[model samples]
Target: MKNSTCLLQPSLATTVALPVIYSFLFPAGSIGNILAAWIFSRQALTKRTQYIYLVNLVSANLLICSTMPFLTVYFARGYQWTYNSVPCGIVNYLGTLIMHVNMYVTIMILSSIALSQYATLKKNSDAQYSQAGNENCQRFLLKKFRQPKFAKYLCIIIWLTVLCVTVIAITRNARARTMEESPRCYNIRVEAGELGAMVLATGCFFLSFMMVLLSYYSLTRHLSEIQRNTCIEEKHLIYRTVKRNIFVIQMILTVCFLPYHIFRPIFYVMLTNNDCPRLNYLVEIKNFLTCLAAAKSSLDPVITLLLDKTFKKSLCGLFTRSTSEQHKRNPDIFIEESPDT
Candidate 1:
């Protein structure tokens, strides 16, 4: 409910520090996202609903990551619009646009993964697990809405929703925070009574989070019930995979998105110069925190590589290519000559 942005004097630290941070981040993010795009482009991703969403998620991240170099230079120039207005506005618009798109798409994708696991459970379980009447209704709803047949449409809808929501952040003709002194490309403002907007954004984040939480809560309760009814020695393979994916999703939110979402409004205040001089020490921390969310674009590929064996196989080939080819050419090199040579 706090004011999102309020006008104040600019700080020297943010001006200097952000460029330094982005200078390091831009190339890394660009390369990582590009590589991810290549990995996801392989024909295998289309078969799995989860990986399909991941592919889109990676594309969204790449969209944002590709823009960082421009922003690095933009911030490096102390908010000056060395570039003209239209390109700046489009870049400014896309900056917020793709970032939030990535967040929402991530939420949707994780939710689908959780629900799909539940559906899988429903398919394999017996009457004891399905005895609850309301539970039947819930499953009916999940079956109706979260069907695999509609996943592509659902992902498209999520993308459109993100664009519709963030388009409001784009200003006309000028850059994001266009002022006489600081003609910058950041979409910050000092509006009164618009605490509702910030609240809505935060609420959407937690709302998506709560949906994910509820899915896991249901999954946990169902899992516990199954564990009790089934034999102790029966390994719950699906349960383990579902649980692990859910955990990884939560970890992604915690490490990559949570800090930025938590500190965003505060950074707006800082960026707008409302508490500029007093909070100058937070400058470096703020720089790192803000970029941390975008850094997930790169980290997501790492996540894909970890969670997906297919991606791991593909990614490993890039590193082991020459050695593998060499071994293929000379089969005796890999042979163990009694370990004595």
Candidate 2:
């Protein structure tokens, strides 16, 4: 009886708690991402390629958030995958596809932002103080930092790469499914095929993260050089703030995803070998990690509200305007022009 009770605890915990948490998280994330999408679309006037990437990132978050309610219910019911086979297949495919899309999009955006900052810093370092007197010099500096062509090509390459990878993964997944009796749903198993999929996903994540980190490091070094040589305190302040923001965003993503990437393989190995005792504990851990990853979709909105000034103002106004009288008293807050060429 005690062993049965222990065995049931993890499943029960997920079944009971996940729905309530997701109930709140899904709506909040959906609303926030919608607002972010709207704001980015309306106010992001920057000609810089990074803004375009930022917009795409928000759009991807919105897409992910749109699917949260369905996922929330599915997971809350103890991972039974109750949806119809067709819908289940579609959802599973889309969920996996969008996750990778989000990952790559964010990495590209962060890398671009870092590169832009580095270019700006380097140019500022070389510019004569007298040359800086002309406003055109500042405009030229901004133009040098703009990389729309690179951003366009990079985005195309990323989507193409993801498309190819997804096709291969889906083909492998379908082939693996033919061997299973339960053909209606995707099941987590410790088969060689599943292991291959996991390896591919983990490798992609690690590679993207490393690229972003290297770009950030390069940008930081260039900024430091500019500060040391130019003595321009204002640019230094902007650089520090942007760096801090990037650091916070990266930290949030890393913390949310680390457990799943690190522990999932161990769980898979234990399950495949019929190691029941180890599998039990690892299953619980995997459930927790799964919840953590889903929570990122929810958290993305809050992060935007906190980090982006325009979104923050919109959110504040949304909550503060309760009555028509209050609405009349408050004027719409417009986003100030972005500092991009």
Among all candidates shown, the one with the greatest TM-score: 1
TM-score of 2: 0.72
- What C-alpha lDDT does candidate 2 achieve relative to the native structure? 0.56
lDDT of 1 by residue, 1-341 (tens): 12223222335555676666667776776777788778667543353555555677777777767667655655555345422465555555455344555655665666666565555555456433445455677767555433544567777887887777666555332442444232333323321113545576667767767766776787788788878877634547656766677677777777776776677667545554445444444444555675776677667766766666655656676887634344234321101111110
TM-score of each: 0.74, 0.72
| Model 1 regions more than 4 Å off | 1-13, 80-91, 94-97, 126-130, 144-146, 171-197, 232-234, 265-275, 279-287, 317-341
Over the stretch 166-196, how does candidate 2's per-residue lDDT look in tens digits?
7877776566445544422323341122566
Q: What lDDT is obtained when candidate 1 is compared to the true structure?
A: 0.57
- By summed lDDT, the worst window of 10 consecutive residues in model 2 runs over 1-10
Clashing residue pairs in candidate 2 (N, C-alpha, C atoms within 3 angstroms): none
Error of 1 at 226 (Å): 1.4
